[model samples]
Target: MAESRSKLVIVGIGDDGLAGMTESARRIVAEAEVILGAPAMLSLLDGLSGRKEALEPDMPAALRQVREALASQRAVLVSGGDPLFYGVARYLCDRLGKDQFEVIPHVSSMQLAFARVKESWEDAYLTSLAGRPLEAVVDRIRTAEKVGLFSSDEHPPNRLARALLDRGIDYFRAYVCENLGSPDERVTQAELTDLASMDFDPLNVLILIRKPNRPDQASRAGRHRLFGNPDDMFAQTLPKRGLITQAEVRSIALAQLDIRPDSVVWDIGAGSGSVAIEAAQLAYQGMVYAVEPEPADVALIEANAESFGVPNVRPVPGRAPEVLASLPDPDAIFVGGTGRQVVLVLRSAYARLCPGGRMAVNVVTIDGLATALETLKNLTSEVQVWNISIARGIEQMDRVRFEAINPTFLLAVTKTPDVSD
Candidate 1:
């Protein structure tokens, strides 16, 4: 009768091989009657009496050897990094059974790559190109702040870079970490265009960190809406971030403004410049002034402006009413809010609005809305009022959730031509 097989041991090896493995892994390899691993991994086993077996190209062939060896001999299989992390161990365990294997994990190359780059991986979008389709990978990477990919021979760093570039996803800085845990280890950092034009070792980990405040380098296909982008798409000021004009209300307010190609617009209390930036897109031939009191918010406005590639938007730092003096009288104006002085700011801003120009105000509180209504009514007999309540759909698991945005009111009025002397 054949001897009963004990559990097969799967040890994760690194580029450094034997010297880098733990004592337990070394001892397990020493005692094994049959060992299986890639040619490079098997070459690391020195001074061992165990029968070394090179892995077959296919999983079934490798499984046959493991099963046959385990019947009369102790079996060991080696893989690079954590065997279950986009490695061979997962397939073997899934094909056979969990009870048949003991897995000893090593640091995955993705983890090592991020460590080499000195960046955090907690929020990174990580995956292996060895199994994923390149098109799917690029789509996932479009909005990611950081990404890590295990580059395979078929989809090496250069090939993957070309794929990204062809799709116009060029906003990230790329790092290719090669031969991790080995003396010949090299980390090459460059722009995606440079990476696409260069070559790299097949044994490499590719990492990408998105540039600050960058919008998608290329436009999404079928995306025709030029304004009122989702709120998260814009860079906002912290602590008071939710102050952004909601996309729904922004669209409505912009419509009310009746902006023209040469319309000079003002976004008072710009609050990270969402309104100002979109308005700038509308008035590309014109100019949009983004006014804010907070210095930090002003910085965000500038960053957001450049990120959106709208040089026409100007971020003016100072409170409204006072700063309004420096700006050219606007053909259109959007008042996000001006604290307790919403009424006061509106009065001053309306005074400078061009004849037949339009102005829109966004107010969140009922009391503030009331104050705006009275103020605007005094300025013009005609006012357009809208109560905007929005909820974004968020799908989790199989169920869907509607995230409600705070309901807000918009007051828009046109400065009557006769009254505008």
Candidate 2:
């Protein structure tokens, strides 16, 4: 009869690896017939009794190799830091089924990284660069007040810092913690600009803590903006500017839409996504679909979404009505532009709206307003229109003069039961 295969043990290692492991953890590693780990992880267990197997950098392939070895002898798979906290333990269990393995966790380097920076990480944005794209990292970092990143070979600290700086994200004070828990452990602190040119060890965690009073590079959290927020308060496209939804118009449309804390909304002509961005804050638990046809505008919307730290707003790169088919049916729809298809777009949007949903349309042209009113009347019995003309008070000499902006028309409609039939 063949000998029964022993269960695989996945052990989390600190910067000190086996040297810092508990007695029980050390016993598991010493008795294993085959031990699997990355080159760096394997280096920590040199001259150990077990036959060491260096794991490949590719995780999926390494997992398969580990499983094959487990079929014969006692096996141990080693990982850096806490195995479940952005470490390999979760991936192994998830991929191979939980019944196949047992996990022994240690303090995560992310935790150590935060500890070294003297910041609480319970609410921080934690992510890893290992095997993930840089774009994902950049997007997450854009609005995070505190971020803990597990650096990768391709996306080292310098590369990450440069990427952030190039995108005009400079509000963070970065701390790079290397060889955590080891005697040679070092933590380097610098501004993003300064870090862009620096070098650090491959085994490092990058911690970013936002500086106080610096305009949060990311969007502010929660709804209820101060009456007059600076234009820079929002994430807007550079160069091809003035495309952001004007703050005044956004406020009016949001009010007309009757946005609740959890109201699902769509900004059909999202442009630079200012309307959808603000609406995301107001509807924290709700989702906002910022639909735009232009690719560049979609990119801007994504940047703005990250800048504002509003994960609820999803940027859909396509025209309205066409893209509307895929979105979760919305409670409110803000139509920013119709491009001569005002009636058609409004009618289609209303059809997809949930019962009692609100629709608000903003039109600068008289023709667009006429089309909006006609379309809105067909959808519901209750229709309200506001001709909003806003003028900012400018200090000229000793007198304050009102600088008038082009008047805008807001058409708001609520779905109500038709009294007739």
Candidate 3:
């Protein structure tokens, strides 16, 4: 986990200039002693003047400048749209610890694009072509019914359309929403073939809605397994399916825990026990305790463990804090949705985390994020935070679209080592 560096503030801006920014965003920018952004982004700050520095064209130079500005003064790094969604926040947070900065987001252009087409975006597969590889999103698009893509100067609408056509998977009706929120904004409706032949404004959103009655086809790759296998791959019950620690999330949490092959691990609020199972995969020689309260779910955990064929995981049937007492000290710990008692569970779990070990907690509510941060920060300074928002693409009624998992915050910290040793 990365250590907290500076208390940096990042504010998201939109095309409507400062008017588009929230009152909170405006105030943060106003109070900033120094502001840093690209030339075009800085141009939007017409009246709300501050000592602003235009970032250098080179990415490394830009990051260095941002680090310096943030470290030296009350600086705001301005970006367009929700900074966490494929924006500067993810990049910066990954490099510098998430606890170092505060993020304020604006309505993203991707959201506006979905709105312009009058399509509800809750199920749309959204992505940006700015830095993503073409092949990566192509297979996903082959199965999706609706997609909202942020087109870049390098991978514009025409090129994207052409690539899809070459794949022999062309059922989408296209909409190019250009220069959104500007006076000269345009929305061009066209077929896939028409889209392939024409140019679009560089600043544009490409929306793809599948033609009606189109059936889904399996990707040539088959149901490729993810590191933290998909939710369905595990044997989980109905309402519990929704409650299971998500595959990608557990993968992240496991990474934060830094579990080694011989590490003794404890998973509080283990739920369906996917996190414990995956941890068992890594800690093949180690022991993983799946601590759950419900008896039926405890059986499900054992079943899932058997299916994975990992004998290292033990399902402990009882509530946390109390059940935690019987367990051995842990080299690493993972706490899932323990709800209101999360603080209690974390306090007890942290006590068992061996010195220089790691603890990672996953929470869904703002209160959880705050209280978890407070509890962990009281114990260790090597704290890192991540806000994960993800959508999974699944086939429905022979067509594919995304099912969004609610936003989650992951907080991980490293316990300090004992000096006497």
* Poorly placed runs, candidate 1 (over 4 Å): 1-3, 217-421
C-alpha lDDT of all candidate models, in order: 0.84, 0.80, 0.82
Q: Over the stretch 328-416, how does candidate 1's per-residue lDDT look in tens digits?
A: 66889999868878778999999888777999999899999999999999988999999999888999999999999899999899886
Give residue 75's lDDT in candidate 1 (0 to 100): 82
- C-alpha TM-score for every candidate: 0.52, 0.53, 0.52
TM-score, structure 1 vs. true: 0.52
Clashing residue pairs in candidate 2 (N, C-alpha, C atoms within 3 angstroms): 218-307, 219-307, 219-308
Displacement of the residue 236 alpha carbon in candidate 2, Å: 28
Which runs in model 2 stand beyond 4 Å of their true positions? Answer: 1-3, 217-421
Clashes of 3: 0
In model 3, residue pairs whose N, Cα or C atoms come closer than 3 Å (at least 3 residues apart or on different chains), thus clashing, are none
RMSD per candidate (Å) reads 23.9, 12.4, 16.7
Better of 1 and 3 by TM-score: 3
- Superposition error at 280 for model 3 (Å): 24
* Superposed model 3: Cα runs more than 4 Å off: 1-6, 56-59, 217-421
Residue by residue across 1-421, what tens digits does model 3's lDDT show? 9654457788888877788877888998988888888777898897766798997865556767877876645789888788898788876775445767899988888888889999999998888876454655676788898999988888899999998888787889999998788778899999889999999878789999999998765555444342478878788778767778888898899888888866789988888888998887777556889999988888889998777766678899889889887776788899885756877888888876777789899998898899999998877766899999999899999999998898899999888764543
Per-residue alpha-carbon lDDT of candidate 2 for residues 82-144, written as tens digits (9 for 90 to 100): 778877776676545666788998888888888888899998888777645465467668878
Best by lDDT: 1
